[model samples]
Target: MEITDRTFPAALVALSGIEFPWDYNEKTEEPAPSNIDYEPYDEFDSAEETTDWIRSWTGNKELDGDAFRMFGQDGTGGIATLWLVRPGQPLVEQPVAFFGSEGEIGIVARSLGEFLWLLAGGVGPQEAVEFGSDSGVPHDELLAVARKYSGIEPRTPAEVLAAAREEFPSFNRTVESWCR
Candidate 1:
């Protein structure tokens, strides 16, 4: 299926329902690492909810988040969404972005396909933006999904991240400008 389809594709719908292994660490005797905090939702968040979240996040009532389609959140309430920056393009063609509850904002992938590879590379939205934080990732469960859905060849997390950042170099500043 095309990644940029108008509707949320079946791949994404299935991804949302995946019960990722977020269990406690047997080696560390601790809860799952905070970096792997992504929890995909059963469905995309409503536009109203997205607007409300953006308003709350930026403390700007005038701004609406209709441009974003939030589908997951990190343990700290950071939002992972498709950023509709490429006007007139299909939704999946737009960049994937992360808006952390703690004021982190960055582009995670250039498109939905890259996003699948990012996941396959063992990087969650939060980890993708936190610079150097690692979560002992690469959840093998998601590789099949990535391979099946990714239109491009598999790439490393670093490659996915660098390409995304380069494509949307001004994303952080853009979001920061929106903040109150």
Candidate 2:
């Protein structure tokens, strides 16, 4: 049911510290990506480490592939997903590069949504929501970004692409700046 199951079995296990099949898309509202590599992973150095690592990945769209969705598999089905996409990506080297970039001034939600949308391409529902919420972009802008990327408008793609083009450099710059 979780989107990570479709592509990132390792990240799931590493973060959850639990074992379960990564294949359950057919039964859930979210669908999995057809192209995925489900590989085995070793346990983290510590459960607490896993928890902290996963918590840091939250809200960071740059690491969606490595993000963790935390929720009770049995309690709230909808709340059971998070994104670690930016974690292992090359972009990860520049974690704080998202501030003060052009096109960064849009609705906060839209900005965050645009950020996540750009980072992960086509992510799951729960992950998308979490990304937008975590970005701290703004509620209204997030909604707009969601609506735009939610496939509600034909122009949303163009809008998102524009935002990405504008922000990518800044994101990279932020990384470069931070690294120095």
Candidate 3:
């Protein structure tokens, strides 16, 4: 799916004004270490770059990046992406996933809609998969944005994380298989 999809762009626009602790400083290529927050990319990674990174990450030149669309990253350079596991489906239908810089991986949300709720609940990709740390601090602005775009009822962080993992139980194993 194209990165210019309606829902994703709308969500990004909604989140444009909010400041997070993990926002990357392009000048320095670093993030503040104080708070658990998301650092959205100014744009999605190009197809070529995504493919190259995936090949490098898995050490499998035979693999292509068509299965993923990386959109953002965490403070530590952990990436957040739309995992297009559902064939012939729109981008919104795909699951949102995270691949941490520290070798952590997980499906964070069932879809972009669920992802908004995850963000509303103050859980970023890294937080959801890594230590499963619950910030317990809700972002009302993000919640509002999520509701505006998704119109889905708010869910707890734990619920979103669990559902995603349950839905894609083999994500880790599948990804690991690609590693040489």
TM-score of each: 0.86, 0.24, 0.84
List model 1 lDDT by residue over 51-108, tens digit each: 9999999999999877888888888799999988777777777889999988988898
Candidate 2, residue 64: how far the Cα is off, in Å: 21
Give the whole-model CA lDDT for all candidates, comma-separated.
0.79, 0.30, 0.76
Better of 1 and 2 by lDDT: 1
Sorted on lDDT, best first, the list reads 1, 3, 2
lDDT of 1 at 115: 88
Instruction: Show the colliding residue pairs in model 3.
Output: none
Q: In angstroms, give how far residue 83 of model 2 lies from its true place.
A: 15
TM-score, cand. 1? 0.86
Worst 10 residues of 2 by lDDT: 100-109
In candidate 1, stretches whose alpha carbon ends up further than 4 angstroms from where it belongs are 1-6, 23-35, 131-135
- Residues 21-118, candidate 2: write the lDDT tens digits: 23336675432432111121342123344354333434332332233323222112332222233543422111111211111211111232343333
- Candidate 2 Cα misplacement greater than 4 A, ranges: 1-110, 115-158
Q: Candidates 1 and 3: which is better by lDDT?
A: 1
Q: What's every prediction's RMSD, in angstroms?
A: 3.9, 15.6, 4.9
Worst 10 residues of 1 by lDDT: 1-10
